[model samples]
Target: MSKIALFGASGTIGSRVRREALDRGHQVTAVVRDPRKITEEHPALTVVTGEVLDAASVAAVAEGHDVVVSAVGGGDGPGHQATIKPAAEVLVEGLRSLGTDAPRLIAVGGAGSLRTPDGAQVWDADGLPEFVLQIMHAHGDALDFYRTVGDVRWTCLSPAAQIEPGERTGRYRTAVDDLIVGADGQSRISAEDYAVALVDEIEDPRHVGERFTVGD
Candidate 1:
């Protein structure tokens, strides 16, 4: 079992991932902006309340970690930018300032950068709701920042066309760059299965120095 430093533990994907990490017998230290917002109490986990947007705070929690997985989304509760971009900027610098080549860092990326049915890459747009688009751009910026890490091990996992809460059947297909859409005319995967891929990728990275997308 590895020791993982997790950010955004109170969020949707982060919450599930924190549970999954603990369920697998791994140790987790969740760094959060507020303590009251976090309600999970795990004997194997440590909840460190701090600003993910502060490189010093993030570096403090990231120390002695085997891996760092960020599931943070920016919003005031789903439609604000105050939470995301700053976090990305901080995480990037935090990893850079670690000054140690020990932990592997993987942040959640966006499906918006993936290709669409038109064979063209899509980008974050204003048409999408504020909450939906916030993380898209944030992740995109995060991944872009990671590109300059020089020696950090990173894999920005881009999800399929559709990602939401659902059942975990322990099965899903993986693809790189483009969106993975099922023949049924949809591209969706449960958060459970998404966590499966995320953990698997964490354990063994097949997309290092690159980005990949998941689908049915």
Candidate 2:
């Protein structure tokens, strides 16, 4: 089983990922900002408290873990701080300090960057709300910084056009360069199934240096 040093374990996506990891029998060192904030506990899980923007602190938590998964979000307040450019910089450098070949990193990226019909990004689509485009640009900027650095073993997962809580059917389409949409034209994917995709990628390496999106 893969030994994972998980960041953002307290959030929605992270929580599901954590449960899925446990179900798969992998050991998880849950790196959170506050260990006491955890509402549930698992024997296979270990909690470490610290900030994600501190490379040294993050590296310390990363020691002995095979891979690192970050389910960081950029919403209002605390989420915004975590999703801002600084968070990406911190993680990029932190992963680098893990010594060139240690701890493969997987980041939770936004779906805004995905392509839409006629070749424009989803966020750039016609009549898209201004606020939505704003955050999408923010995530694009974060990932842009990541491209300038090397020595970081990393890949990003962009879920289906829409991601929310639902059942885990383990049934979803995978794509390398484009977002997957159902026949009806809406792209929605369950968080549980997304967890399945993430953990499966953790177990078997694929789509390195490439971006893949999943949907129903």
Candidate 3:
């Protein structure tokens, strides 16, 4: 079983990812700002106080873990500009301090940078609110940062256009950069299934040192 370190474990997507990992018989360390926020109980789960933007804290929690999953700002909008890109930098910096023994990093990404069927990007679509644009761009910026780093073993998984709490069919399609549009012309994936894909990736390495998106 893989020893996983997870940031933002109290958030929507993070909680689902934690549950998925624990259900798969993996050991999970739920790192959060407030440990009391994580109310779930699992034999393989351990909650701890930590900050995603702090390299020291990241290193402390990341050491000895097989994978470090960051779900920070995965489904938020208010202050993503401050956390998303900065968190990416801190995570890489912390992991780099460990040299060659650092665990692999899997960061939750956004769909804004994905190319649409017409070749335009998702963030280029009209009628998007200003705050929504900020969050999307924040993730885009983080992805851009990840691409520049060749030393760290990192994988960014971007969700589809729409993601919310739903059933997990344990099935989804994936793409490297283009948006995965189904036959109905809609791009979407339930958060549960997204966790399934993330854990599946952890179990089987693919798209290493790159980004990929998922959809129903």
Candidate 4:
């Protein structure tokens, strides 16, 4: 079983990933700000309380892991959606301080930056709603940061345009640098399946130093 250090373990996608990892018999170190929020207890799971934006804190929790996954998201409040970039920066710095790049990093990214078949970014698509623009921009910045960073072996997994709580079919399709649309012409995936894809990638490395998207 691979050792995984997961940030934002109490969030929607993070929680799913944590469960999937444990179900697959992997050792998971779930890093969260509040340990009480994560009530799931597993023999293979270790909960660590720390700040994702602090380099030292992140590094301390990330030590001795085979892979690091960040499933962080912006909170409900307005303008709080831009934390992904800062968190990415801190994660990179923390990983670099380890003095060895053994633990590869994978981040849960937004689908707004994904490219359509016509080559237009989802963020720039016509008639896009204004409310989600900030979150999209933040995720775009985070993806850009990962793309440009050289020291860390990182990959950003962008989910389908519409992600929600649904059944885990343990099945999905993946595409690199472009959006994956279903037969019905919509891009979507369940949170549980997204976690499945992530843990699958963790077990077998693909899309290294790049971004990939998942869809039903």
Best by TM-score: 3
Q: Which has the higher lDDT value, candidate number 1 or candidate number 2?
A: 2
Q: What is the lDDT of residue 184 in candidate 3?
A: 97
What are the runs in model 1 whose C-alpha is more than 4 Å off?
Answer: 74-79, 124-135
lDDT of 1: 0.76
Q: What does the lDDT read for residue 53 in candidate 2?
A: 80
Per-residue lDDT value at 144 in model 3? 98
Off by over 4 Å in 2: 74-82
Could you tell me every candidate's TM-score relative to the true structure? 0.87, 0.92, 0.98, 0.96
lDDT of 2 at 181: 80
Tens digits of per-residue lDDT for model 3, 46-83 = 99999988999999999999999999874455666678
Model 2, 115: alpha-carbon shift in Å?
1.1
lDDT of the candidates, in the order given: 0.76, 0.80, 0.94, 0.91
Candidate 1 residue lDDT tens string, 19-84: 778887889988787878878677998988867778888788888998888888744355544555
Compose the digit string of candidate 4's lDDT tens values, residues 84-188: 899999999999898775588999999999999889988988776565888888899988889898888999999999998899999999999899998898999
Q: Supply the TM-score for candidate 3.
A: 0.98
Cα deviation in Å at residue 120, candidate 2? 1.4
